[model samples]
Target: MLTELHIRHFAIVKSLDIEFRNGMTAITGETGAGKSIALDALSLCLGSRADASLVRPGCDKAEITACFAVAKDSPAARWLAEQDLDAEDECVLRRIINKDGRSKAWINGSPVPLAQQKSLAPLLVNIHGQHEHQLLTRDEHQLHLLDQFARHNHLLEATKAHYRQWADTEKQYRQQQQAKADREAQRQLLEYQVGELDEFALAEGEFEQLEADHKRLSNHRSLDEASLFALNALYEGEHNNANGLVQSAGQRLQESVDMDPQLGSINELLKQAMVHIEEAALELRHYQDQMHIDSAELETIEQRMTQALKLAKKHQCSAAELYPLHQQLKSELQTLIATDEASEQLAEQRQTLRQAYREQAKKLFDSRQRAANQLSDKITSAMQQLNMPHGRFEISVDHDNQAPATAKGTDQVQFLVSANPGQPLQPISKVASGGELSRISLAIQVMSATQQTVPTMMFDEVDVGVSGPTAAVVGSMLRELGGQCQIICVTHLPQVAAKAHQQLQVAKHTDGKETQTDVRALNNDERVVELARLLGGDKVTDLTKANAKELLAS
Candidate 1:
């Protein structure tokens, strides 16, 4: 319930602080006595769109703060917990709007976005007035009310989950099908790619080796000529060969060594030279053997190397990457095949989920239809008590053909009413006058209040169109509702005011040239006088006061 409200520099309200009590609290004053100002300030705290024009003429900013003490299990507290804000026995919402067209909001002194503040506002309070009659006028809201009345939140949640799954599956199925269809045009290219890569079958390190071998083989005749010339030079014909020359030198040195001691060192050096020349001659012969080249084998190597290069270019990769590319393509092909199976499986799962959703939706629709009827009947009865005795009301639950097959079991709910006897029942928005609609709106709210979980419900002049016995019944209904939840009503009806547990009289006082609104809680005597004023107008005669006292006593 709203515990307090503080407003500053907002519209006609310069500064005001009022503490509200539980149960029915009435705010009454003359038409322009700022009764609606208080409600407007409360609306500001609830995150309503702010305008710089709402600020006092001479002030830089306007501010409003509302304090609520909610039960631990109340939805407001639960909402606060979800927002990670302070939900401790009390919650405070504050909003400030600067003259520069900027606004800021806070929840429990913690800064928050306006949207979050708005979401939490409904949990704490419901301010129903002429504008909100649209809620009762809409079919979707009727369905929502029915769902709320039935407390089918768990089943509704299950339905939503099923919806999400069904939607996700449908999206996935479409995407996969589209992808498969698009891939059709690329199928020939993909297969050709796989086949071309497979044919080359290039081996690692083969390219570099082949290039070197090709160069050598391409100059095979020249290489043979060079090897033969080298061999001839190293171990030339018979007597001119390097080995024969070295042996001759060694034999001459050995004969000299027998004649002179210096010849001994010369003979050792000659023997070493002879050994090196013979080794060189053997290496030349080995080189000649290795130079043997076959033209046919060389052609085969060249052709394979050229094909490998061509395949690398066609695939936009190097020859070494061709093997890995083949593996990648094969793996992708395998995945495509597996996706076909998985898609079929998902389709089956989707069908199963769709069936479950259908069952749940049908159950939900049936429950709403029943709840709607009950709600309609209850509201109609209450409307008769509110003085529209001839008002005919109906809760129209019509089937909607435009609803998707997957929709929550195809029911479109609407509220219809007729304010006059024998008149055709029309949609609530069409058949009800403004004031008649006001009472009907109040009746609808009063009927739903017992089932709604909100802690506080405010009705701005709910008795606007009601009088006499109807006003008395409206007062009784409010009093009864106040016992269950906090109720605040702004009304000109003395009957309604007389039944309130507490009455806060709003009066305007002039300080010099400025008029300010002040709210005072009325005591028993004051309540009688205020009620008398509402009943008897400016002339609160002794008889009228006595009558007011009698009304209060009753």
Candidate 2:
């Protein structure tokens, strides 16, 4: 419930402060007399777009503040808490617009974004006007409003979860199908590469061994000639042969060894050298015989080494890495082979999720239909006293099973109306006049408010195009609804304005060169004059005041 509103330098309202109360409190003023300014101020706090042009000509900025008495668990309070804003049992919202077209909004003294303001607005007040009736025409908004009125929040949450599940499942199914399609192209590439690698059949360390063999074979003739020459010089050469020379020296050293013991040790050393020289010559002969060069084998080994190096460079890796690369390709091939294996499983899972989505959607549709019938009947009963004797209102539920399911549901619901006798009921947007729409909107609001948990309801211009008994009925209905929650109605009807438990009059006054609008809570005597002014005009005649008093007395 809005407890108070303060406006400064906003439009024609230089400054205004008004305290509001529970039950219907009407605001009455002449046309262009700043009644809409009060509503505009409220709209600013409720997140409506701000225009710098609304500022008083000489003012630098326009500001509006609205205070609401909120419940601890009220949606508005909850929203404020979620946004990390200050919220207590009472909430104060302030909006300021500067002359440069910049605007700032605050909740409970904490600055907040405009989006947060909009998200929190509905929790503070619900305004039903000529435009708000669009809620009845739009399918999703209608469902949401109806569910709110029915207090089926938990059910709506469940439906939303199911909708999300359906969407997620479809997304996964599409991805899996695309993966299957992509696998075929990948398989062709993997198969060709794997075939090439398998055919090579290269051995580990084989490249190193081949390189060694190629070097040895390339110098085989030179190695053979050097070994043969060394062998002849060591064992078979004339006087310079190492074996013959060392033996001859050992014989001389032994003959001399008898002359001295040191000569005998030197002879032993000479004999050892002769033995080692003979062993070396024998090994050289063996190598000379084994050094047979085969050009064909050398060519084959050289070609193998060249091919390995070329493949390594082409793949930008060493020859040793080719084996691991082969294994990777084989693994990918297996994955491609198994792509169709899981296809059936995906289809089955999709069917199951589809069935679950349908079941949840069906349950939501059934609950809405049941609740819509009750709501339609309740609102029709309330519309009777507003002067449409044979007035009929209905909720037409159209199932869109063939249409794709949306987040709300697979059903479309609209409010239908017939304003006069024998007139076929049509969509509320199509058949209702401004007066009829006002009353219908009020009736629906009354019904919806009764079922809501909100602590306040604010009505702006709800009494437009209504007067006399119709306005009285509207006022009485608002009062009745106010018994359930805080109700505030902005009106110009003297009949309705007179019915307020509290009366606030919006008066514009020009003091010297300054123009200002201020809202005042009228005392009983003042209310008489205000209502008389509403009934008559700028001039409140004595007869008008008498009639106003009489109306109050009744």
Highest TM-score: give the candidate number. 1
Give the per-residue lDDT of model 2 (tens digit) for 1-554: 88888888888887788888887777777676777677778888889998879888888999999998887777877777787775678899999999987999998898989988888887878766535654666766766778777676776777678778878878877887878767777888889878887887667667767777988899887888788889988997876788888888888888887788788878888888888888998898788777787889988988887877777777788876776777777888987777656666667877887777778778888888888899989888878878878888888777766668677778888888888889998888786487787778777877877887667676777666677888888777887877887777778888877777888777778869987777888899999998898888889999999989977775
Residue-level lDDT of model 1, residues 1-554, one tens digit each, is 99999999887678899999999988888777878788888998888888889988789999999999978887788888887996689999999999987999999999999999889888898887745576776767777666666667777777787877878888898887878776655555667777776676665577778888999999989988887877786676555776677778888878787679798888888788877877887887888878777989899988988888788787898876766777788677667667778888988988897777777777777777777788888888998888888887778776543467544456777788888888888888785378888788778878877787788988888666678888889899999999998999988989888889999988877778777777779899999898889888988989889989988987
Give the runs in model 2 whose Cα sits over 4 Å from its true position: 134-141, 175-182, 199-324, 331-349, 432-434, 539-543
| C-alpha lDDT of candidate 2 relative to the true structure | 0.80
lDDT of 1 at 409: 52
Instruction: Give TM-scores for every candidate, taking all chains together and pairing residue i with residue i.
Output: 0.83, 0.80
At residue 387, give the lDDT of candidate 2. 83
Best by lDDT: 1
Q: What lDDT is obtained when candidate 1 is compared to the true structure?
A: 0.82
Lowest lDDT block of 10, candidate 2: 128-137
Q: Name the runs in model 1 displaced over 4 angstroms.
A: 205-210, 228-292, 302-353, 388-392, 398-402, 405-410, 418-426, 432-435
